[model samples]
Target: MSVRARGTLGRFLLTLLVALLALGMPLAPANADPTVGPAQDEPLPVTVNLTKITPTFADSSTPVHVEAELTNTGDETITELWIRLQRDQWISTRAQLQIVDDQQPPYAWAMSAPTSLSAPLDPGDSMSVTLTVSRDELVMYDAGAYPILLNVYGTVDGWENHVGQAAFTMPHADQRPDTPLGVSWVLPLIDQPRRVSGTDVFTDDTLATEISSGGRLENILDAAEEYGEQAKISLVVDPALIDALDAMSDGYQVRTDTGNIDGAGAEAAASFLTRLTDVADTSAIIATPYSDVDAVALVRAGMPEVLSDARTYGADIITDVLDTDPITNIAWPADGIMTDDTWQTLVADGVDTALLSGASYGQEDYLESPLGITESASTVLPNGRAIVADPGLSRLLTAAPQYAGGPVPAAQRITAELAMISLQMPTEARNVVLAPPRDWAPSEQLLDDLFTTTTNADWLTPMSLQQVSEGPPVDRGPLQYPATLSEQELPGNILESFAAPLQQVAELGSAFDPEDTDEALWPTRAALFDAASSAWRGGDGSAVSNGLDTANDALATLRAQIHIVTPSDGTYTLTSSDAPLVFTIENNLPWDVHYRIGIDESRSVGLTAEDVGVQTIPGGTRATVQLPTSVERSGAFTVVAQIRTPDGDPLGNDVQINVSSSAYGTAALWVTGIAFTALLALIARRWWRRHLFWAEERRKRADAQAHQLREDAGDHGQHEYRSDDAIVPPDFAGYDVPPRDEHR
Candidate 1:
């Protein structure tokens, strides 16, 4: 091969082998190291990250350990790599030097032998190394924070430079501030209880496991056990979860998609509740409103009644269930943002404090909230106080350790940042608050390591909410919340729209409740609150939407049960007008319902009857009501049946009946029969009178003829002998000439 071609082949072959090493494959049997190929402005083809620095504040006697990880970012294999720790006395603090020049330091601390890489690191491959500086070699004369740099020297084809820095503190005479660094570690022990459709029963065992022996909840318990009464660390809890556990204490049925299953999760949940109560006794417990209600949304949706109920009554409900007095005067809205109206409403509802986001304090830059500045203060509302959490510190405290090189490294970074806060204000002590992520999932080991590091940090003095509340306040800007309230408004409107029927259900169920504490209806109320949970953050809003759908389904079912029962075809028939229009009211609900049944005026059918006032129907029973209705010449008519609450609010849907009345009334038949009898008698009398008159006329005629015959018998009396032997004339059967002469 030509020289140039051979060189290209050599580079390609080396890269191929390094790729294999990155994939944990065997390398090719070629000269692994080649002479320097080309020069670039950036020396090293590797990235060195100083993962951690142990003993951040150490004396000469304490061993100084520097740990870092080096990754080969270049395509070629890293044939040689070395890490060196350097110290510069000219730069006492971390902020002094922004850039590192090629100029050598004026004063250099004693150097240790560079830690060598164990094996060649392939491209995209990383190796961790620990560099140590012995106490005999390094000495510290002053007590202050010092800047230390990790210089990485690596060779691909030639040597290159990569660098990072960390701060080290050597306390003066091992002395921290006499007042101590006031710190507040707020741990959130919250879980959104599962709200499945068509159920008031607590059934999921996974929830139980999460609160059981080795779950995330157990980590908080362990912290509580370790921290004892260190007043500064607080625990914020969701009451809905506690209520769910209380319900699950007995054998419970967990709802599944297909059906329900008998679950053993409740036992574990009960155990967790007991443990939580114990923790509450020792630590400050902040009970959130049941299900973490979305106050802003409720206010925007014009549901001040619901918002008031959640804030004012949640504390009592939680206390009764948990048997512990949690701080209920404080309100924590979702995303820690509430509009002015919502805030004022909460204040009116007896909320004295509100936990808000840094954004509420006009701090758009999450991490830049002024801690040491005297002007850093919480805003004051009409009847409440708003405390803005340091968003940066809160994020850093809860940041996943893996994202920041591991727990220890992340902890060290946290310590360094905290130390800088004190360093910035050596004479004054400031209160720093740390709120972990709302839905934090921490490993036991990680939690232990973090708490150990934090509690032992000489500069930090952990304070509880009670203690922090007593501290001096800082001056802050006006209250500010996110302009968008649509998310909250939508769900709130949904709940409001269904509120009346739900309230009726609650009242109805409560009446029949054997326990009489409203516990029977609490699950449904909790579900409504669940549907409005602020935990439904950015996304498609499926969580809240699903919750709303579930609630609507439940309410719809409840309303359906208290309705006018009709045929499958939704029609009714009246065989007789006398048979009062009778229909059945089916109360499918589990409690008695007092409802009024009446005709809908909008119907085309004319029906008249006394109003069927409120009737109490026992739950799960069917009752028939007979309404005396008069149909006006009806072959077919539409009867619109209305079912309503005692207050006249519509329930369910209006039932329509196609009624056909085929029976006649008795009074009208009697009157027609009497009139027909009278007319028949009158006609018979007239016929009798006419017949009598004709008979009499005939008799008179006969007598007249007999007299004539007597007079004529002497002359011609043959026709006068007998009435049956009458002679007939040709024109008039007797004597037409004689009759005519008599008439004349």
Candidate 2:
């Protein structure tokens, strides 16, 4: 407690501390060599920006951009930075996906593009790349959800270094809108008029282009080269002046020739017209300014699909189904001439078409319907030496010179306009839309195969690729002689053309609404292109969830009339409150579907049990129960309709409903028996408990008697049982000999 004592204790503690420090510290003779090697072992500092994911448009071959930001964290100078993204091999499957990169191929068996890019990052810098996907692909083995490791390993001050890795995702891969885009295949009609160049003549490679934006020179060169390779197009002139083409006010419509024609020409034209009738069911062919009319008249001489011009268009066998209108188009910039002010005034004038020469009209000589789009990044057509058609003149031109006597209805015009526009797309699932296809084939029948939905997705399209019956195009010849061109070597490379279209489509990058192009536009632009494509129908941001209650009401009504049956032969009878009679739809999983519906022997209209329903599914999503008709229809007793899923599982969701009027139903006596049986079980349980208690008492008494018998039967020599842990106590007199030897 004294001050002196306290001082002594403090001194002792200080001495102890010094001794401990000496033991743990690095020890060496006064001066030794410093530790060898560089001062820092940690890699140049690296930071991966998880937020910079750049989005690509929906339906674009390219997918969402999984962007990154890298910064040098170490003092060492970073040079030749190499970044690598590896699919979490531990988590992702070898089957479910396709990864497109030099490092990782999209499909396991296919080659992927090189993903490594070389760059130098002075202590702090960044770079980016994009990955593409579709609505179906996004769900099956989605890139957005997959664990991705981006490792940045490169040379740092002459030594190999790894910048470490940061986790990131192409979050927008499915962020694309579910909004159905109106996509349609523009097929060039089988035959119109094709120019046959005997010597394989082609346009000059140096022809000037008219497309206003992007890389026009490169595009024209590419298109020309593609046509040359296919040997499908002919060049009318060296490049055919396109300068005034955009400026022109109207397009020319060719018709059948009305005047007399030579014998050979007549037969050929007639054969051509007859084939046309075979496809579209036409009555006759009208004459054109360059007509060989006698030929058309001869062709109209006979055929079943077509009728003479004087008669009806064709056979009326389609009486059962109402005929649909034809799709139409109007050529724009009617003439091959225009001024800069021309195209600028088009929006104000309500015109919607344009024509361009030195462009892709499929094969140049063919009368293919083409849509003229302004191309490129800086489409400067309206600026310098170029001229564009005034919008007002374009509209005027379409009504007269463009169509002339052609039968293009106004409604058809608007429909075509509605078919081609594209909007922003997010990479999320909500933004992806799937439209079911009734069948898969390449023909006009494809149009009817489209699925219509109340969902935001608004259109349908058929793929342009035709399945070649393991061979080349069939020669279903009319045995006709078409136009011939001078044999001049065309100037373009086929390789450049095909690749260029894909490249051009890619270069579209991101287009913005003229007014909102700055950083401030991110919120609104994000909203428009983000995944809520179906949910948010407009700029106001209305959600689809709000209308679900009404959807429930609709569901209730629909459920009432559906048909049910595992198979019409099954014995289980199912009854519901509002069933009259219904039908069922079935699907086969992963393959085709089988549908069977039982029909009433008496009613003989509409679809019957023989009719099978088709299921339209996109990859991972399951086939749904779709109501073919109202379920309230009451009819004769019937059990029908069933289809399996792509996985071969049974789903009666597609089944129809039927009335079950008490066929061998349950009885009230069954309920009474169950109640009495429970009471009897409770009584038996109590009796068993009482018996067990008495049995335990008898066993205890017997055990005690056995113990007493053993002691009485034997001498039971004196024995001591003492607690080894406890000390023995001595009585007042000396107890029998204790530990101090009694003998001693």
Candidate 3:
């Protein structure tokens, strides 16, 4: 036969076979309802809510008991309602466990018979249902998490369909892993800063409720107290919280909108502190930087020194309050994520160990090996090691309560996931760390179940964080910090807003004399640190802004206390151009303040004011400062006087002084000129009068001598003529030469 003819016959036979298969397949009826089952936009006829599941983990002999509630939420609910428990195949790997809901495993087993409802359920009606799967009826051989579906079947609107369903995980613990997985639980006891800046007052009284019985903090403390000895749990506490609690225990005040009132958490705070002390005595404690400050934001804001201050101050507070030296070299950034710069900053700050999320590294770089070795929980960097927490487990512990099925199912799933992880590499030991949100507040029951699961699970061995860090590290390439995590950080603008107040307070602290202690400014500095906390992330930053304002106000108040007292009548009179301008400095604070008087002479035309080099005013006293001022001309001029630190930072308000100088500037020269002229005239008059007197005396002597000479000449004319007397007669002409002539 020809090849073309054979090919045509083969194609015809294949087409006929396809047609035969299509005809044999079943087809839907013409009147079939496509919307018979649950639709996305339509409400279910019934809803199933699992209230309780006894024995979270089951064995062969253990009968599983489930208590649930069935509610008719739709408009129509008919008769013959029956509920049964269905189980799927066991989940084998973590990847499978993540998408357990998407995979429809074959039905393994169910109750002996479906439990029927006694009465027809009407709209908005609820019925309590209980189901028990006896050991004789149900059997399981696998040791992993099984997806269990609670299904309800009933006739709704004259149609029979699956009316409601609720799915959850059921752990069947029939066997144990050869090597148990090492687990570490790191719990956080952190909160926002509550104390007002630079005062013994709190911003609000919410902390009072938080520390009372059955409160968030109380529950955390209770859990630690109940489970500390049973499991290896590490508590990471914020020193800022400890500081506030200590202040509260000592009878602090709470500031309200109106005014400050006495706080009501004194007793509660005292009790909590006592219990915390006891807890710290036996448990491993890790100290967070003061207020759990946003390290990355601070570093980005150009305030890296704040990190050192926070760590040192926080460590000191923890040591003093808890009487225990906490682990200080480990840094756990909020959300377990940070940028490379933040990582480098932390490493430079002496942090040798960091608790980070598993997702922080590239996942493709560390895929599961054939031997079932997945990503390791620890990684080695250049200068430090990161204890990578399992992101899956961390989310389960931190966000379980918010799940749709609630934390009970989440707790069971946690156990199942642990079992699956252990079973993956049963022969090789692996480590995992479970870290919750920094501000987590779990209920007592949830805490109990989680702690119990860790203790009872034969495939998990609880280990300390320190022990977990010492394990071998996995190389997952460079860190891959998510952009989403960075978006959730305390913003850069808010951090920038903190710079002014921080610098102001720091300058205020520096203004103190070397011998004087600057203890007064500690609260202000702490408040500035609190403003940079990670708690302000995702918020409008109003609270943090308010905290900063309070700190600035405190510095302003302190500065206002030490100012140049304005003179009476707001005027200063200088008697001379070179007279010193005296200023009264009032130091109302309790400590000696060292400051320099800065005078603004720009407005004064011919005035020059000297800076009274740093001057110290004793506590609760006033001192006088003499600023040497020179005025070229006498007139009224304005000069601004301000109190300034030695660093030249203006402190208080500038005092404007209207200076009036009564100095005889040009008038003194005119008066001296006139007095010198009068003195010259009087001297001339005296000299002329003396000359006239001398002339008169010489004339009288001459006249008398002439008269005497005339008489003597008349007398001697008859006697004798002297040639010598005749020749000297001409010399006596306007002078008193009579004596010389007589001597001759």
Question: Looking at model 2, which ten-residue stretch has the lowest summed lDDT?
Answer: 286-295
Residue ranges of candidate 2 with Cα displaced over 4 Å:
1-152, 160-178, 184-329, 332-352, 355-744
TM-scores, all candidates, are: 0.68, 0.17, 0.76
lDDT of 1 by residue, 1-744 (tens): 985576456545644543444354211112211111232355345555555566765655666787777777778877656665544442333333212111223223433346777688888888888888753334333444443445556555574433222222222223455445566777787776574533546535667677766687777777777874653468888777776777677667877788887877766877777877777778888877777777787787777776676654567766887787778777777767778888788777777887777767666434233342322224555665766666656655555333223454455545654564555555676666667777776666556656776687677777766555556655465677655633534444355554654566555552333553254355456566777776765445566666766666665665676788776766566666555777788877667777777888667454454587777788789999877765544466687888877667666578878877675445444566788888888999999999999999998897786667566545543433545746332222454355656866
RMSD of each candidate?
12.1, 42.3, 10.0
Hey, what RMSD does candidate 3 come out at?
10.0
Best by TM-score: 3
In each prediction, how many residue pairs overlap at the backbone (N, C-alpha, C within less than 3 A)?
10, 89, 0
Q: What does the lDDT read for residue 393 in candidate 3? A: 79
Candidate 3: which stretches are off by over 4 Å?
A: 1-52, 68-82, 101-112, 116-129, 135-139, 151-166, 200-205, 250-266, 364-376, 493-506, 513-518, 538-551, 574-580, 604-612, 626-636, 664-744
Model 1 poorest 10 in a row by lDDT: 27-36
Decreasing TM-score order of the candidates: 3, 1, 2
